[model samples]
Target: MKVNCPTCQSEVEWSAESPFRPFCSKRCQLIDLGEWAAEEKRIPAQATQEELERALPDIEEIEAMLAQQGDSFFRDH
Candidate 1:
């Protein structure tokens, strides 16, 4: 049975158990990902949960943000 795509409403001919069930083709999958990346339709955080946990926090790396914070804030640190 053909499935209707939620985005373009095009018919997809994927088997029920196919790994690529939702996306009819690789191009469609990549296009969906591009939309998400370009739109930034995800949680708005300074960093993702995985990134914040895995990566080391560096003040120098975010020096521009540092400049905005008042000296009193850093002086307290």
Candidate 2:
């Protein structure tokens, strides 16, 4: 099977012989990695309600936890 490299659009043999099967070469692979690292590429989606809830603690919950901990949280053990 063959597929175009995602990074360079070069034809690539989809096999073990092609280590970078989806990319033309290490350079192309790195370019794609860099783009992703730089946030140039991303999967578009909205966070689900469950996802949003799990993303962070509620403000009241945070305050309660902080009150429970008092100033001990600021001290080093």
Candidate 3:
């Protein structure tokens, strides 16, 4: 089978002996999670339309808080 590394986007060969079969390496695996945690990449919710309508305000508030603290919380430099 074949898979691509989530981080480097390199081609990954799958085999029993390949420990980093899915992610390319431990670092790459963690990088993907970091992307998720930092919201650098987005994941869609399974909520219905009505739920999303009700959730927009909450999401906005969360984004506002993140914007306020994000520079301090996740500093790149």
Candidate 4:
């Protein structure tokens, strides 16, 4: 199989013999790594403080709920 390099978009062979399977060469691979290190590449996400607070249950609430449920929930059949 053949695929494009993530950094240079160059054609690359997908095989064990190809040292850099996803990248055309070490240079392209390093370039992608550098982009990540420099914060140039990022995963899109938006979460306000209020949104996060609402999304996650409080630790105490989680503990209480787990206590109510007991260890039976985790027991293997």
Candidate 5:
């Protein structure tokens, strides 16, 4: 089967042989990655404040945990 590459719009073979199945080549794949990294492409969604709060740790909690863990927490594990 063949499908259009999301990055370059080139036809790509959807097979195990094609390492970048959804993209034509590594360049195209990287281009797509760059776009996502740069926030040029975004997944459409509407998140509530409650959802956002639940998804992220509080800054105070993070600071307290880091203070308790100390520098060794990052170096050792």
Candidate 6:
């Protein structure tokens, strides 16, 4: 079997003889590692509940915002 290297798109044999099955050479493997380390490569994911909560405005901030808006914010029409 053969597979293309994730970094260089070079063909690599998928076997025990091929140390880096998904990468053509050590250079290609290192390049892919560097991309990941630099945050250039990322897996799509949803924010965790804790992360979402942390991003939301706290009670104090919400109150401050409401105070800044004043009574008109509550007035209908």
lDDT of each: 0.42, 0.50, 0.50, 0.50, 0.51, 0.49
- Candidate 3 TM-score to native: 0.42
Worst 10 residues of 3 by lDDT: 40-49
**TM-score (all chains, Cα) for each model:** 0.37, 0.46, 0.42, 0.46, 0.46, 0.45
lDDT of 1 by residue, 27-75 (tens): 3333343344334333233433354334423334334344564334322
How well does candidate 3 score on lDDT at residue 25?
Answer: 56
Candidate 4 steric clashes: 0
Candidate 4 lDDT by residue in tens digits, 1-77:
99987755667899976677687765454444343333533312343334434543343444454456573532212
Error of 2 at 18 (Å): 0.5
Model 3 CA lDDT for position 6: 59
Model 5 spans with C-alpha error above 4 angstroms: 38-77
**Poorest lDDT segment (10 consecutive residues) of candidate 5:** 40-49
Per-residue lDDT of model 5, residues 11-65, tens digit only: 8999987787687765454444443333533322332334434433343444455
**Strongest candidate by lDDT:** 5
**Candidate 5: lDDT of 31?**
40
- Which residues of candidate 6, in runs, are more than 4 Å off? 38-77
Cα lDDT of model 6 by residue, 10-50, tens digit: 67899977776677655444434433333533312343334
Ten contiguous residues minimizing lDDT sum, candidate 1: 68-77
Q: Tell me the lDDT of model 5 at 39.
A: 54
The parts of candidate 3 lying over 4 Å away from their true place are 39-77
Q: Ten residues in a row with the worst lDDT in model 6?
A: 40-49
